[model samples]
Target: MLPVVLPLPLYAADASNTMVVSAAPAASGLSELDTPAAVSVVSGDDMRQAAPRVNLSENLSSVPGLQIENRQNYAQDLQLSVRGFGSRSTFGVRGIRIYVDGIPATMPDGQGQTSNVDIGSIDHIEVLRGPFSALYGNSSGGVINIDTQTGQQPTTLEAGTWFGSYGSWRNSLKVSGATGDGTHAGDVNYTVSTSRFTTHGYRDHSGAEKNLANAKLGVRLDDASTLTLLFNSVHVKADDPGGLTPDMWRADPHQVASNVSIYNARKTVDQTQAGLHYVRQMGENDDLSVMMYAGIRETTQYQSLPASSQSSAAHPGGVIDLTRHYQGIDTRWTHRDTLFSIPVSFTGGVDYETMMERRKGYLNFSNNGTSTDYGVMGDMRRNERNLMWNLDPYLQTSWQLTNKLSLDAGLRYSSVYFDSNDYYITTGNGDDSGSTSYHRWLPAAALKYAFDDSWNAYLSAGRGFETPTINELAYRSGGVSGLNINLKPATSDTIELGTKKRIGNGLISAAVFQTDTQNEIVTDTSSNGRSTYKNAGQTRRRGLELGLDQQFAYDWRLKAAWTLLDARYRTNACGTANCDGNRIPGIARSMAYAGLEYAPEQGWYGGAEIRYMSDIAANDANSVKAPAYSITSLNTGYKWLLSNWTLDMFGRVDNLFDRNYIGSVIVNESNSRYYEPAPGRNYSVGLTVTYAFQ
Candidate 1:
């Protein structure tokens, strides 16, 4: 799709637009074009312009095949999925590998949360969405790598504030600097930032508040070694409005579900983490790198469950208090050499991670020998200490077989272990403790053929596996006791064919992929407000994605993306005799997005976007559905640069048409309170000022 037009200087390679896939690389490394995978990069400057810069969904709408929905209830986090892989998660992220800087954000059990991400200081985000992502180990349906901003020449201080509808406000401050000159061992750079955000929320009792801080320091040593240290902390308190039934949603979308106020349904989290990275050049053909990180997270949550359910000795109570300590280290060695007289590079590494948790549960009420207060702590129902760990050794290599052809391959051996100790035991609740372990050998391969400088084609295939998360195994169905130790892991084999084409001043890409899954984990039963899971026979998911980015004259740009997915159960699900061919729930079948922006060096700049998502099934049986909807938004801003100071003012309006829609859903809720409504109309405004000094 070549246009008869000359390329402008704006499309040329520059620091701002030079895209790279830092996550998928050999010892010598390779650029995005040379990686032979479906990868995309979104620059920070583009994300910061006329945006809230708060959530990942706000800036990632242009990336095809990624579905993100704002649940409005921050306590539950956002609902995100890549190629229908993680759509079933009720909280946090599943089936994806997330990393910030050089540290792992996903836990050893493959559960991840983005509440700690410092979006204000992000420099760029890289998304890898194909078979190649299997190299990252467990639950890697996709990989997301976020890189924070580095200090520039001349120290700079920035302060910003934003105000939005629903009584929402955000304030932030940042400082960064660099010292010394070129190649010197004493050279250093540092960046520090902090922010506070609060929201009244669109629905009743859904308010939330958060405080976050991040810091990074880098030092060069002896011109052959470098060290970087990173630290981050976050505290959050939020009210869970809970989900609404279809009748309740139709009556009043802004109302909280029943019994939420009585139980004070809420959640609180505090976390602090730090990491260190070291790199050194060995000889002329070898390099070594090492990374170590540790973190602590504390959480306390209250749920709305009836007292009758707690009367059963098997119940785990409605109040949960958990403290988790996690740490990990990774080391790698790379050798740049020739294989059979052909240019080749190889990298081998091992990663070890472990986590321990002190978990306790208590009833939500006390009898007090009189009337019961619904929110007071009554009796301890459960007390347990649990541990989980994983170890993996991986090797990757890339070879240039010919001038226009290349081959890349990798292998990894993964092992995961879990164990728990029960402390609270009585006649009714006997010793209900157990241990389990899982292991797998994962492999990936890809072949790339370059038709010319402007076009490239590739085919890749891989095998992936996902073990049962700790939370998923904590409880069993039918009000049974102890953990579901009989659960099995899910395995998948995927294949994809993709092509990338460079137009005059833009790029176009498309991919077709298919995956077959065995022993797919799914919800088995939801009784007494507790959920459990079991393995399904088999499942299938196939999808197509298309993306385009074009820049025209006069600083105007157009960005668009579209995705079509067909996911279904190929065999009996939920232990049914023959409920095969049912559509998988919680994921939209078709999605589309488009945006247009016009920005110049000076004067006013503005943009508008349109997004659409098709209807979705809400359960494994496909008995209920959520209607499809479309939304439109507009954003505008102005910038002024005078002397050593820069000033920017921006405003945005979401749901410009004020269309009523379901923003997200809780898949297969036992209580049938599945709908989470979107706000009708909303507005936000912000101002940023930066000063540069020596």
Candidate 2:
């Protein structure tokens, strides 16, 4: 039942093979050694061992009820959560559901961004937690799927670079191949990757730059058909180190915030995408699949609101702009026989998504006539045109029923819709315009038992929903300026119990869970930096999790994970006042990780790690906090295999003992500027060069 903990999974990049998880709705897809709920997988050579493969929190810290922060702000991105379900996101990623190869990097109103995942062309990463992730419809609460790296059989070329601590760097290039070996029928396969990154941040008006590109193509046509094509692009510009006031992070956790150098805060982005996938085999128990995608994105920001905070005519300014276009499609069908005699499978799908946006606002200050020019981009208060859409229909099933019992189930029927139009009318912002919609019917189930071959036990249940993101419906809880469109939608219910074992080369796991939510969507005020939201009545989350991984002597390995969460507010909470039962403001009531390794496959290699977090809760009258921290890290690497060329060298050190934490939090920042400081001792190094053609 889930948890091979974090090592053990590969379908390529062969870390001793094992993997199969198609976002787990099942019909044929399960592994974490026969999945039964919470899941994890990392691979891609453990995301480039001795990594600097650029953020994914550097290889997902041996996952355990996810929470990967790192607001070492690339202009706010990366602050994921699960279990406490996205912990009231402060920027991107909301309640999870992201995918890379089969397209969707979450949209259709849920907001997502991994700044274009390109872990140098990854090949694995699948996380799915709790009750089959609500069948992947709105805000699934957990689901991450990224897969890239396929274009096999010889022919290769790679180049890489790395550097770190404050002035950072990254560079990459890759090429892969394949052409015959698909059992005839016009074979083809390919891969391409590109990267560039730069940073000079660790606070102080943070800086950043990024560029990335990716491509994949496959075609096999004739033997049961296949086709694939995908492309990706991203561009970013950043500088926005704004958050810190717990006495300016105890008098300087890397300084910035003097209104962030007087409003020079920043952000910029551009994106491009493409996708298509198809597969067929319609005979012998049927099968079929299809996917399609499209994208466009643009963003601009610059906020540190102050020059009179846009002299309100119902101000919606401080500069922010957006443009978006999106698309999606999915179709699936699957079937297999036997029912009363057990042994079944079934799948059905339909998904459609859409987004269309154009939002604007300006005034970061500029007045000319002898005054003001703070960060330029003056006038034009706000304008809007937004639309969102979603439609889903799904079903999944599986059963074996004997020889150790098994079952899986799913159902989905999600719908979402929103529309807004406004066009900058003002005299106190008239013409507000709005629309709304939401619907749900998600269900899930699971059961598994297998006391024999390496133990297992499981149980699961589900239902989930969350829908408010248009930046939480743009502003209206009292500071009122249109579009909050009467917020409401945040349902939930979940349950889990798990167990796993395989103890020799080692693997062990445990879990216990609970969730119960209703309404639940807090934060109800923010003025200069603009934020507003409400709906909060009941909430709860209870958790416990643990994991371990092992191997010995023959190139040692060991890993560990732990989590315990409580997250609460079970009544009387909405924009403050007698919080009925606090905690749950930026979540974290325990977390831990451990790692050790001695890898092999050329020459000496090494690893070490430790992490812990606890203290967090910076609002909702829990007063304030963001302390509890422990960190340690170290890495080493070397590899060289001649013949066709291969070399890899690496190094790392982080925190080690430097400590002085608070790496993320901004929960109710009406100006208290909730911390975000992390980075004490740091270092990095890297190398990679490869060549092959056979």
Candidate 3:
């Protein structure tokens, strides 16, 4: 295993705040909210204390109703599902929208897939659950908004390093401060960082490596206005061991094959994002913010297939390359005032985006003629272009019926349009072309009542819709009819009731929700061994979520959450009706998390956390189930403050018990008969130090 090197000169020790003005009580509290949805915020301080080793998905595993499945590789295997909405996908994120500083991170073609984010620069994350299409068009499941750190404090210098098991190591440094030296504080704040990560991977032929760089600059125009520029980039190189079949796992979970004939798969991805945000106060009672962003992302991936069931005489061993580009713009406005003694607020926004993508397949032949040899010729080429546009308008009002009672109501409407052009070609064969389009409407409403500062309750309902992604539509060949352009958009309706209560210094929250979806997309393998995508029948999911956060007078704190879900196919005309009543594939019926922490004024702190997930069915047939698993982690840190410098040290132990389990499962692409496991237990740790000048 190669030594893991943390990109140095990119780490910082000074902590930053993560509070956003949008979520302030005076801006839009629970009683004044406009949408029928659930939202939660994870502060930057909280994320720093947690110190996750990987990306956003790993850091958010504790969020209620969220499931993150890490496939251990950098590409095509990371799976993130919310409320069982994105489990059927093969690569990249789907069924949810991800935004950074209000810029759409997901592509325009309904494919919410991308890995351009730099978690180290993020200051806060806001998770909005249920159908929020009325707020963000064309998405039915949920929304993730990431806010990065800006110029909030004076100049400072920071750096850090991390070392742990599996030859892992990471180093970073950062500097940020005011540009002016005197009382005239009209200066800009800037931050730049870079990091490299590597791991020997648990299995043979699975080691991976990555490099990332990010920067941000913020200029304060006035007390009520600011402008900021952002940039981020990442490069990755990794080996693919290929997922193991269910039978292989049961026979020998630790066994890994290393073949001399297997060609090493390699991939490289580059992403650059640039955006400008302007915030201005329209008046004392209203405010408006506008942001424009443009991003370009490119990727090249090569894969060598062994003599698997996917290989054939007509289609021997081969390699494939994929590439893509995306661009978009977004804007929003907020207005608030009193009408007839009742508080009223209005919000509206519009977004436009375009995307272009292409794929090429190559074949190589060996003297032995084994299915594992890469043939010596190009087999196919595919190209696609997609365009999308959305508009949303919403209104919310609240009235205080009495000193202790309040009423809240809201409404929103969303419209979306999607169009795509696809083309395919085979060696010496002519090109085949096709085009398709889809449209949808979504709405949401909510009612909330607050008894006092310590207690609140609410009921909400909303509609959501999702169009088929480009990948599901463009990867078909001869015997395989590619691109289901005629497929209809999937639709969902959800209703939820919840309450939040605070007693003493402790907080408790609970919610129950039910969602019914139609036109769910399903991928099925035919007798010819090619996978086909189609819209399936209806499916229902209902669940309850409970969470508790408490702090003791002695500096001890406890946080915990539990979820119970009932998901099943309600109707299926595809002869798979028996899937009814079965637990949803890729979802655990029950999951729980608990954490204990101790932080005192003395500058020393530590914490321990445990997460548990119940067994999950690998497929709709319910013939196979991935066993339940639990993982424990511990972290500790100490800080020392002086007149000119601040020193700190921190470390953590993941998979404390070293339990073996599969992070995710999927049906084999070549054979309709089996499933594959992701990875097992692993560990990592790191530390940070800083210096400052006033």
Error of 2 at 518 (Å): 35
Worst 10 residues of 2 by lDDT: 5-14
lDDT for predicted candidate 1 compared with the true structure: 0.82
lDDT string for model 3 (102-192, tens) is 6677765556654655566666666677644334556548777776665435667777666666555556666666575312335688777
Superposed Cα RMSD, model 1: 5.1
- Which candidate, 1 or 3, has the higher lDDT? 1
lDDT of 2 at 255: 92
Which order, best to worst by TM-score?
Answer: 1, 3, 2
lDDT of 1 at 655: 99
Please write out the lDDT profile of model 2 over residues 143-203, one tens digit for every residue.
Answer: 8888888787777999999999888999999999898876568898899999899988887
TM-scores of the candidates are 0.95, 0.34, 0.86
Candidate of highest TM-score: 1
Ten-residue stretch with the least lDDT total in model 3:
3-12
Q: State the lDDT of candidate 1 residue by residue for 270-350, as single tens digits.
A: 999999888787876677778889999999888888888888887778898899999998887766677676767677889
